[model samples]
Target: MSVDVTWLGHSTVTVDVRDTTGDTGGDPAGRLRIVTDPVLRAGLAHLRRRPRTPDPSASAGCDLALVSHLHHDHLDLPSLRRLRPAVLVTPPGASDWVRWRLRLPATRVLEVAVGGTAELELAGGAVRVSALPAHHAGHRTGSGLSRAPRDARAVEHLVRVPGAFPARAETDLLLWAVGDTGEFEASDAVLDAAGRAPDVALVPVGGWGHTLGPHHLDPRQAAELVARVRPVHSVPVHWGTLHPVALSRTMGDRFVDPGPRFVEHARRLGVPGAVHLPVGGRLTLDGTGQGTR
Candidate 1:
């Protein structure tokens, strides 16, 4: 059993797994497809395509699409509306909005809370997903900066409420956890729930703005995160997709080096099994209980 991951640049990866042991239809090809934080646009705002285009969507029909958080980049409604996968998973309490955004039925949605797990049967294979905690915030707001102590709450990254998900669900079994945070305040709890290591950790490394703060990780910090979660392998995303066009004109080609820098840092830190795939790559996975280690 083996898992192939195609880097879709800027953190989106297609995790293709083939479990030879499972009976996933007569064709083995159908059991492969994991779409993570997909941003398929050739250009967004000022950021242009840095890598190749993804394997044609028809050819890469998705089995499972993972949305690790609620940030705009990861939980993009525009991108989500494009794929017609067998199942879609997201953080707990986010099914409503996701369903609304795509006008999808509750039957196809799975919300996973941190520490929760759900089994899914798709394309003749059974897969499991568990919600792990992220320390970052998922503030859809990207305008205006507030530094006043009273206005500090304006950061708008984390949103916690009593079961305040986008909408309600009826009987979706697989829990699609939207791990929408990456802050230290809840990191311990997240660490406890996901165990000593994560099967697949989709972390954020860049921000919509120029600086890193209470919301997301920079290149160096992302490298450290890799050391922390220690998943089997990783693919970078969330940068270079929506950088300010004016910002690039000022910095030249070096403007979009953060993702590449992260790859370097992972290598420098001896990130065993880590692979940096260019955008639009394809992967197949075999979740036969053999972890990335």
Candidate 2:
């Protein structure tokens, strides 16, 4: 179980997981690539990506892409097109929006409900991703109101395709990617679905705005989440990346402040380990799976 996790920017993370044990199903070169909430484009409308952020192409080549909600930053169409994950997982209602409105025709978008599992059989072994319930609002179009495309059958041709992952090698990596969820109910659903704690928990500690609004977690609340779920290792995300184009000068530091604040809270709470990665920082866990800070 060797896992390499890199925070590309914002909620986007690239996890390269490999199994070192003999149980690699006879394939040793297998790698499971998982990415979450990819907002790869350098600019989003009026909101410009700050300095030192990875380019859109940095998110390319993932076996599976997970979307926690339908917000513009989290589910950007152009970003997804650039990343081109073999399999895309979203909340139950978002698949249609992504398929037609977002214009993703070829990608296999599987809308998974809370407690439902999207199982992937790789050359190494099986990878199970459970879509846990999220507390945030799922509907966010440029206009507040936008209906699904009239032709439901337009995307019927690309429903399920096998052979997404390459033939490779073994070990298990359970990742609970909780994106921008503020409520405990969402976490409880994740815990209920995950029989054991996740190897790494990618939690959102803050957003770009000066204020932390409803269905969002600030540094302290996010610390509470880490204390409750208690994963082997926790990485703070959704901060230090995108910012509103017209924020007040006084609150500008909010963008770069949350990650370290969350780490401090996690320490005070006595959590196992906290990897407060910079915008492009990375962390690795070897086969032994020790929580090294």
How does model 2 fare in lDDT?
Answer: 0.68
Each model's C-alpha lDDT? 0.52, 0.68
**Cα lDDT tens digits for candidate 2, 19-51:** 554464532224567788888767776566775
Root-mean-square deviation of candidate 1: 8.9
The residue-level lDDT of candidate 2 at 49 comes to: 76
- Model 2 regions more than 4 Å off: 19-30, 102-107, 122-125, 143-171, 248-250, 291-293
**Highest TM-score: which candidate?**
2
Query: Candidate 1, which segments miss by more than 4 Å at Cα?
Result: 19-29, 43-55, 142-203, 245-247, 251-256, 267-270, 281-293
lDDT of 1 by residue, 1-293 (tens): 45555556555656555545557675434445667666666555345554455556522577777766555556666677776666787665666666776778887877766566676677535666655555555334442331111211111111111111112331111111223334455443434544334344444556545565575667777777676656545555565545555554544433366667877888898875444444444433333323332
The per-residue C-alpha lDDT of model 2 at residue 82 equals: 79
How does each model score on TM-score? 0.69, 0.82
Best model number under lDDT: 2
